[model samples]
Target: MDLKNVDLNLLVVFNDLLNTGRVGQTAERLGMTQPAVSNCLARLRRLLGDDLFIRTQQGMVPTPYAEALAEPVSYALGAIHSALNQSVVFDPARSRQNFVIAMTDIGEIHFLPALMARLAAVAPGVSVSTVRNLSIDLPREMEAGNVHLAIGLLPDLQTGFFQRRLFGQHYVCLYRHGHPLDHPGGMTLEDFTAAEHVGVVAAGTGHGIVDDLLARMGVARRLRLQVPHFVAVGHILRNTDMVATVPQVLAQCIAGPFGLSWCAHPVSLPEVSIGLFWHSKFHRDAANQWLRAQIVAIRPDGVDGGRTEDGATAL
Candidate 1:
């Protein structure tokens, strides 16, 4: 694997081939002839000592080896692409840079509206994309510039990244307004544990702490349904007797639309700290700094407006 011997264009062809799985389609995307794509694939086959894609009647199916190489190669290409496209001067008002953020469904519901509103006012051309990758390695994605920032309570992102504390939140018991359980007195430990609950199986988030905290307190929830995300929880609670234990920010976000009410958790759950995480790799990238500033404004408490790790107070 001598880097000096390999052609960069071949890797680009390999990536597009791996995505499109056809010489003609790959050529169409890369603006090259089919022969050129096939030639590049040949060079890649010799370099890697494997037939990366096997052509079938349907399409080119990746071999086991190619499957293994797909993610890393895409990341490498993405890092190179990001590096090449980095702007020296980021004028948010006119720049059409699209920032990719990694967050959970909870963040989409809770953070996006405020963020987009701010972006529309200041940087109308700046676009945003959000990804919720529970299985993804956040650090690797950030390192490759695939994800510009991650907003959540991802403890896994603690090491090898710079983060700004956006807010800390506690769990709340959310249910419909007219439910039998909804009361001025709020949820008691008995109501929390005995009620049929919709347990959100949010794998890579701070909400997991709620279940752990309940376990420690010797409390049990009668889970009637389990879901992977929180976007549907409020809807479910609106129509069913099930209550959900979720972050206060999320509860607040969903409450109005679904006619829901939330109260203090009876079981004394610890506050889960949420933050804006970014790799130091793009700390000084002007576009990155500007986007980070917009996110800091949408903080749950909306007070802390300071310099990010990039050392930029405002764009």
Candidate 2:
């Protein structure tokens, strides 16, 4: 347990073994002989008092202790690497780095296209990966460095994280342009409740917002279909008479091309705030700051402010 007595290089070997699963492959990756790698593993086992990894037909299986250590150890190593890699000046034009983000399909639809275009033009060498939003522990994921950024509507973010508002979104009723409801120019609560509705329920605060709004107004729609993503709602609206209440930006993107029309929600709904979240550990990272700035810059105007209870104006 004494950190000063342990060799840091052994952890690197341990990580390689865990990743490659085969001792020979681990040795090759580390440019060491198989015997040396085996010796290092033995030393690690003795030091940690655990087997760490058990060989399996499929691959190396981490012991419970190793599983517990994996995230923290990997995170520590990553932070060390980032600290060592820091430069006095960041040169975006030539740097090759990978950034991992966690966002819902809606966020991907609205934010990624322009963001990728900008990155392609300015920082062509940078790479991006996105993971679907799930009801998992986001704070742990961010703290462990599994995700560099989390962008979406957060109900109650943990205190240690850094949050920056990227945009605001309001709900709008979307239907096919020539659908039966289009003639009225706008929908009333009666019409909305009568029409077939498509609903999207994603992780975080999305579903509750719609439900709360409906409860407040003493109105509820006949939900004919339920899907997990807003992107699917667009497709369903294109081919059917069912209308969906979706974020304004998403509706705007699909309305014209899909022969869709949008009207203000019949009952007032609270505006949803979309923000970019990251751990405080990365708050001062130059590349992270640049990426956040790019996201904020490309967000649609008038959607960056806080909303009120009645959804009248930004606070």
- Model 1 spans > 4 angstroms off: 1-87, 305-315
lDDT of 2 by residue, 1-315 (tens): 779988988988886666567899878867999999989989999999999999889777889998788656765665675586556455679889888888888778878898899999999999888986565556656654567888888755555566777777788999987899997658988899899998787647455678766877788788999887777776788799998988888887888878899999887887877777776546556777677767777887835445231232211
Query: Which residue pairs collide, candidate 1?
Result: none
What are the models' TM-scores? 0.72, 0.70
RMSD, every candidate, angstroms: 5.4, 6.5
Model 1, range 231-283, lDDT digits (tens) per residue? 88988999998889888998888899999999998877788778788875576
Lowest lDDT sum, 10 consecutive residues, model 2, at: 306-315
Minimal lDDT window, size 10, model 1: 306-315
